[model samples]
Target chain A: EPEVTQTPSHQVTQMGQEVILRCVPISNHLYFYWYRQILGQKVEFLVSFYNNEISEKSEIFDDQFSVERPDGSNFTLKIRSTKLEDSAMYFCASSRVQSENEKLFFGSGTQLSVL
Target chain B: LAKTTQPISMDSYEGQEVNITCSHNNIATNDYITWYQQFPSQGPRFIIQGYKTKVTNEVASLFIPADRKSSTLSLPRVSLSDTAVYYCLVGDPMNTGFQKLVFGTGTRLLVSP
Candidate 1:
């Protein structure tokens, strides 16, 4: 089964530094998304990308965050200035279709540790 | 997006059947109910989904009652390895352009010997 793949399984960064997490969605997937799960918290939506543009974003996706489909296969999330609260598990997901019952393929996730 | 409510945790013995129910009282007609299971340090995996009635798969079964206000995930003859967090999400499929899946604090299932 094809899957979404994320890089840098774990990352450690100091506060105020920029960090980027990368993902390679399934080759045939048309919609991509980024979500974060804070330790002991629920997974929250960050942003959704389609057609090389941001289709939607959550309030948690503020000025500090941005997403890009740098290439046909690579999607990235960049945080300009990280804070201690930014520590969490960032997940990348993709869905082949936009159907109500469609299931998302998720990566193992990139654990971002902002110190 | 509809809000979902589930129990914080559940405990079951090995070899027993377990049922976890999620309530989405304000579900829309176009919304579908889907469940995902997550182990520690990993991403959520699709378990089962149902629009209405009962849908069964190899891993689990999804039961959506009439009214569409709630759904149940049934795990039969579970084992210790089946311990994980289960999340229920409700969203419309037509809004595919930016369909965001909002996850609530999932129900943590602890299966022990």
Candidate 2:
């Protein structure tokens, strides 16, 4: 089965630094998403992107965060001025369609650690 | 988005069938119930999805009643490797348009030998 692929499985950065997480969603998928989970917490939606534009975003995705489909296959999440609270496993997901019954394919996740 | 309620945790033995129930009292006409499983340190994996009635795949079976107020995810003959957290989500993608899923605290399932 095809899967979403994220690069730099582990990232360590200092507070106030900039970080960019990269993901390659399934080739045929049309919708992309970013989600995060603090250790031992429920997964939280960050943002969704479709047709090269942001479809929706959560409050957690504030000015510090942005997503871009830099190319045909690569989707990226950039966080500027990272804080200690930014430490978490960030996941990338994709779906062929944005429907009530469509299932998302998720990557293993990028573990972002801000010191 | 309809809120879901499920047990916080469950314990089972290897070779036993595990059924995790999730309740969504406010499910809408277009909402669908979907289940995802996550092992430690990994992203959630899709298991099964159903709008109503029973939907079964190679991995698990989803049973939704006529009222659609609740759904059950049945794992047949579970093993220790099956230990994971299972999430149940309810949403209407057509209405919301590119809906971002809201994941609640999922049920933790531990299968022992």
Candidate 3:
């Protein structure tokens, strides 16, 4: 089974620095999403993308965050001037299409650690 | 937003049937009940999803009442490998868009031998 894969499984960056997390969603998936889990907190959605454009974003996706699909397979999340609270397990998910029966398949996740 | 309520933790043994219940009092008509499983340091995986009555798959079963206010995820013959956190989410997963999903503190199921 094809799975969503993320790069830099572990990322450590200094506070105020910039970081870009990357993901290659499963082939044939048309929708992509990004979410974060702050340690013990529940997984929170950040943004969703489709047709190379952002569909929806959450409050957590403020000025510092941006998502891009610069290529056919790679989806990336860029955070400018990172903050300590931004440290969390960032997940990349993809779905076949938009439907209630369509399940979002996730990648192993990239653990972002801010110093 | 539909807020779902579920247990914090549960304990089960091998060969036992495990059922975790979730209540979403404000669920909308278009929302579908879905369940996911997660191990530590990993992303959540889809288990099952249902709109009403009962829906069963090889891995698990999802039962939603007529009111659509609550749903149950049933795992049969759970074992050690079944130890993980289970999350119940209600939402509309149509192509129109994806919402910023807020997964509550999930129910931790510990299945022992």
Candidate 4:
């Protein structure tokens, strides 16, 4: 089965540096999303994208965060300036639509570690 | 988004049947009950989902009562490898735009052999 794929399974960066996590969702999937889980915490929604534009975002997705689909397959999340609290497992997910019963395909996740 | 409540943890013996229930008292009519299993250092994996009644797949079973206020995930003959965190999510998903799954603090299961 086709699955979502993310790059840089792990990333370590300085507190003020920039970081980008890349993902390639299933080709046929039309919608994409980003979520993050701080160690031992619930997975929190970051943002959702569709029709080549952002649909919704959470409070945590402040001005510092941005998402882009640079090409047909690659979707990326960039943090302009990182903080220690930004360290977490960032996951990429995709689905055909927002069907109540639809299942979202998730990548293995990119572990971001900011020091 | 509906709030769900689940026990923090559970313990099971090898070969025992394990049932973990999640309560979403205010689940919307269009919401679906989905369960996911996660291991440390990896993303979560979908287990099973049900709108109502009982739905069973090769990996596990999902039981949703009529009120739609609660659901149960049943694992048969669980083994040591079955040890992991289980999450129950209840949502319409229509507004998330990506079927974005909102996972709660999952129920951690420890299987002893």
Local distance difference test scores for all models: 0.92, 0.94, 0.90, 0.91
For candidate 2, the per-residue lDDT at B45 reads 95
Compared with the true structure, what per-residue lDDT tens digits does model 4 show for residues B1-113? 78999999999999999999999998988887889898887778888988999999999999988898999999999999999999998887676446666788899999998
Chain B vs. true chain B: TM-score per candidate: 0.96, 0.97, 0.93, 0.97
- Considering just the first chain, candidate 4 attains a TM-score of 0.97
For candidate 3 chain B, the 10 contiguous residues with the lowest summed lDDT are: B93-102
The fraction of reference interface contacts (C-alpha pairs within 8 A across chains A and B) present in each candidate is: 0.86, 0.82, 0.90, 0.73
Better candidate by DockQ, 2 or 3? 2
Residue A70 in candidate 1, Cα distance off native in Å = 1.6
**What is the DockQ for all candidates, taken in turn?**
0.78, 0.79, 0.77, 0.71
**TM, chain A, every candidate:** 0.97, 0.98, 0.98, 0.97
lDDT of 3 by residue, B23-54 (tens): 99999888888889999899999899899999
- Candidate 1 residues lying further than 4 Å off, grouped into runs, are none
Question: Mind giving the per-residue lDDT tens digits that candidate 4 earns over A1-115?
Answer: 7889999999999999999999999999889999999998998889999989998888999999999999999999999999999999999988876666778788899999999
- Whichever of 1 and 3 has more lDDT, that candidate is 1
Model 1 lDDT, residue A115, Cα: 88
Lowest summed lDDT across 10 adjacent residues in model 3 chain A is found at A95-104
Q: Where does the lowest 10-residue lDDT sum fall in candidate 2 chain A? A: A97-106
